[model samples]
Target: MNAAPADQIRLLDVQAFDVRLQQLAHRRKSLPEHTEIQSLTKDLTQMRDLLVAAQTEESDCAREQTKAEQDVDQVRTRAARDQQRLDSGAVTSPKDLAGLQHEITSLAKRQGDLEDVVLEVMERRESAQERVAELTERVSSVQAKADDAVARRDAACEELDGEAASVAKEREVVAGVVPADLIALYDKLRAQQGGIGAAKLYQRTCQGCRQELAITELAEIRSAAPDTVVRCENCRRILVRTSESGL
Candidate 1:
């Protein structure tokens, strides 16, 4: 691997841009808004389940209340007819009169019992309605939160995407200055080296592997030509040299 001295130095800028791209990708994935949206979505699902259950219970309670009221109405209607007959003097015979009075008393009691049941059912239905209302409000609240999180996440994504696009365009220009073969080698090495294809040789250390170069390794590099491609002996990564290399 060999390149013009200037191309090798230019490759450093290419590598810097690549590192920046990786960092941007990592930041996008780890954004707090992304996490918040996920959590909010999960909460929304749970809230939906709870809301469905509450609605079902409320409906059932409403139906029960209606039935209870219907029963009360039926009993009261029968009692009203009995009282009408008694008041009309349709039972003049003493035995008939006594029987009519007794029947009226029984009907009144039945109506009262039915009314009590209606009241109880009404109370239960009211409670169920309250529960439904509460759950509905909660669902709305959680949905709003989820929506806000999504909006924030999207805004951040758009900003990052714009920056990434700009950086990618710059990379294309940087890549153009570097030799094709050298770029190919860097790409291949990056694939095998955990995304780090190049690093600087600074202070007698291979930054790629963070390993110090021994005297013999330093002597070899010193003897090499400036345009000759150099590799870190430890990590086999292209080691770009600069004035700060502390040769």
Candidate 2:
């Protein structure tokens, strides 16, 4: 189809804007912040898991400590009752008294052992609580980082979107200059030619296909009218000639 030489050249502007828009879109999706966000999200998940485990351990340890302390209390209460009975001279039989005294000694040893168990459990519980606290703090720290990463990722995307909006507006203006039929052709070719509908004929090569045209084809293109829309014999994309086309 015949379009003004200047109009055909304007099609290149549309192509340029479209390509820039594509690049901007790609940049928005492939930002480094996107990768950072993914990594931060993964860390947040792992950190939460660790915190949960720590909380479970602390709770279990606390229960064990309570039971241990109760065990020690029960042993001490029994020992106290035995001591009181021995002091009151309740067991008047000499053999019974001797047995009561021996029973008191054994109760004292048992109380000591239970107290030792309570101390060990308390220490373990305390350590588990400390671990929970540490993990909680770490989770908060990593959560803050993840939030920052999300903010950064969002901001970067917004900036790219804003730029793309501006480029799109420019593309609309550039596209308005070309005739409807030419745009239809360009759109069709763009769909078929990997998003490149037209390319500059730089030197002797068709930039769209990056191939040099045969001399016979070059001669025909040179001989064609200035208003003619030349297509590459190799790629069939509209070849927009320029001063550098070496026609």
lDDT of each: 0.87, 0.89
Whole-model lDDT, model 2: 0.89
What ranges in model 1 sit over 4 Å off? Answer: 93-96
lDDT of 2 by residue, 207-247 (tens): 89999999999999999999999999999999998899988
Using TM-score, give the best candidate's number: 1
Q: Each candidate's TM vs. the true structure? A: 0.93, 0.90
| C-alpha RMSD for every candidate | 1.7, 2.0
| lDDT string, candidate 1, 147-212, tens digits | 988888889888988898899899899999899999999888888998889888999898889999
Q: Could you tell me how far off, in angstroms, the CA of residue 86 lies in candidate 1 after the best superposition?
A: 2.0
